[model samples]
Target: MLKRVFQALSGARPGEQLPVLLSFMALLCLLLSYYLVKPLRDSMFLSYYQASDLAYMAIVVTVSSLVVIKFFNHWVGRIPRYRLMSITYAVMMICKLLFLLILPISGRWGTVVFYLWASVYFTLVLSILWGVINTIFSARQAERSFGFVALGATLGNISGAKLSAWLAGSAFKDWALLLSIGAMSAALGLILLAVQIASRDPETARKQSGTAALHVSRGMQDIVSLFGNGYVRGIALMVFTLALISMAVQFQAYGQIDRNTAATVYGEEFAWFDPPGQHFEVIYGLKKLDAAAQQARLKALGRSGNLPTAQIQELSQSFGRYQKQFESRTRKVLSDVYAYQGLLGVFLLVVVARFLFRFVGLRYTVLILPAFYALAAMVLMFPLEIALIQVLLVIGGALNYSLNNATKELLYTPTSEAVRFQLKPLIEGPVMRLGDVTASLLQIGISTALALWLALTEMSQGRLLLALGLLFIAAWMLAIWATGRRYDQAQQADPPRQELDLHA
Candidate 1:
């Protein structure tokens, strides 16, 4: 039944089945992890630690992830992609065991530690896994199959988004139950990865590495070489743009989100739900309430639209007033209680985003990620007046995860087989996941700066988020553009004529 379902859905090719099957299976694991754990993030840890502290943990983990990638990239090339993947999973299994037993019993700090490891660890594995895929396939096949891969993640994402709310509403309100579910989902992904590797023929595996070679570090060489070589650098730049705009996109989207998110009661503001004028207030905050306004905006867009997130971020130069807009709204929002307003709104916004993926093609979708971010910023920063920053941020997060998954799949295609096994994981798992860790630390460092200055003057922290997000995005755009330019220039050949024509 499952095979039939996949066969029916997978387009472009009927002969190739296994990779599609594995991607879908992996996506299931991803979705399961997302749905089971996301809801409890606040309950488990945010209540205990400052977002800044959490960010620091991420930074630490990213650095460690980098090390893991280095280990894989330098050595894995000596072996087969599938076998190396199995080795990586074995390490993860050990970590999972330790995480399941040690952290659960260890309490708060333990959980936080595990969160960092869990967050950074999986992506580290995936990067190498993809590097392997890039080595094995042609560019065109990668493109066609990407959606299938994304479909798995999308299904997983939507399910996860719904699960958070669904579990809460149903009898499964227990945090322990949610945590258990999360473990199962994550474990499921690991198992699927194992299965994908295990399915490889024994004869094929032995041919590549009758003997296993030790892995070593090229030690920033890959990254440095990435910069030095024009083509590699281009891909890196594109990846960077994806990362940077992803930040700005979160804030911008949040700003627009406020136009729709009606205020609800929680904490000291509990009495305001019954108040007059609340409904009318945010609608106008949207800054584009008329049907004409929305149509005008949509009409201005191509399938992906014109103004990428990198460009829209330029508005921040308007006195830092619009930039401050992000912070003020965030502060206003934090004043709301989590149950009615924060959690509910964030939930709907992210789920809606899942479906939007189908509307855009992968390359164009990624190329313009920066612009979408800018749109989100315009809405949050200027319109709904930044009140719904969290909602927008969540939207951005979903986009970041989904869009990049598509882009990276393409990148992996052109790489050589050995490089894919060795370097790919480093790229996917550590390098990519490391970005999250970096963002967390960045948030903390900026927050600390604000705290120090708050006594002397009002430090605009919300704008601070917007600024960091924009900076990352802008730099990313420039890099990706440069990469694209080089790729377009990859040695095009003069036509090859028949030998008979030359003889004639």
Candidate 2:
């Protein structure tokens, strides 16, 4: 029964199941560890920096990724695979612990460093982890097992997001402790992964014995060599385009989060729930009133009775003066709510991805991902209620975890192992980060151009964001088409060993 289930899930034979399971667990722990602190990272960055500055921060991440990857290459050659993996895990834990200490004392500067560190850790750690997986399995084994192993990442995302949300809601909401928990989880997972690698594949230890260090100079050469290859360039472009849309969607979600927090902050001071003339006397009055119930409260507050201009002005001034104390609580609640909803979306990805991969080929199923972004952008481009905006963001995020992540990994299978080892890091790291930088610059440029037009001609930022989203989505679609075509050609030229019949 276990063999049958493993066959259905990963197309792996009974002999391969243990290694696949180990790979899955390793990824699950790694992603969960990162995501545990992810919400806090988002909140911190937005709190300290403007939304527009995200692009600039992404550029920093790009540079940091390059540096780390170079460092990774150097170490991979000198250390045993298991020992290096252990060291990698230890370094990540130390960084997380340091972040816990710094977050309390260093203020915004800590946030800035945390943001950069998290980006580097996320990029480098995942790259190294995947590289390890590739090293352990033959290309044929990877083709069969990677899809199932990749599911662990999705599961990890859900587990971590849910854990973080729960912590956020709890009274003893010490972020420092939460981060410590995540770091520890990562360490435990990595240690187990090391044991599994050492025990199962002693040959890997032999391969690592005397490999030369990957020099920093060679990193740039690897990147340049990739762009020079048409096939690799196509893969890079696909990643680049997808990254643009993903980052843009994230930016908008952050925008929504910021807007929600701002509303919560000033909801007491401003008549946000009702028309300008009709105001709730207290926060409870606003909080308790459902749409239908609000009418009765408005009437009780003398909605029909015209207040003098001076009284209205005084009421507005008095509002939020005492209520400022509660703003932290409100923001925390809002952030947690969104975080929970995001967790739900990730959970949904687990279900949706299984169905897609089962029924549709990897090549075709991923095409659906860009459609999700397109539809989301089209719907959200116009004026939308906050509730609807949150819903759309959830849907987009679900699609991201479901199709985007899995499909991207599968694309690597048709390529040579050298490409898988060297070029993939370049693609996933710098090229992907380059896309983010492009998106960020574009976002800033479009917003600035629109703002100037708005001063002269009354265009809204919402419509501008939507327009930019559509533009990027179009590019994303083209990229999907191009990459899909190229991938099909590549597969036909060099088919996967033990390839499952898509029709079956």
TM-score for model 2? 0.74
State model 2's lDDT. Answer: 0.61
Candidate 1 total steric clashes? 42
Model 2, 1-504: lDDT tens digits are: 867977887666656677778777777777777777666676656654556578789888888877776676565546665567667777778777777777867856787898888776776667667766755564445556666777777667666666666665576455733564565466456545644654455444433332333433344676676777655666687778667777876676666566456555555445433445333334334433333454444344443446565544454444434233233443354445445544654554445555554455555765786787778777766667767767776666655654576666666554544455566777778878887877777777666775676652222555565567677667666666665555554445544332212111
List runs of model 2 lying over 4 Å from the truth.
74-82, 138-144, 175-219, 265-360, 453-459, 465-472, 479-482, 489-504
Candidate 1 lDDT, tens digit per residue, 1-504? 766666545532544456556655565555545444444443344323433344456567667777766766765546554666666666765666565566546756675776666666656555544544443334444455555555565555555555555554455544423354454446445545544553463422432333234334456755654345444444555554454445334323433333333232111121222135433333233232333553344333312335465433332122133212332333233322222332433342234322323334333444565766766644544434343555555555545555555564654454444334544555555555455655555555556775576632213454566566677666666666554433222212132110111011
Alpha-carbon RMSD to native, per candidate: 15.4, 8.5
> What is each predicted model's overall lDDT from 0 to 1?
0.47, 0.61
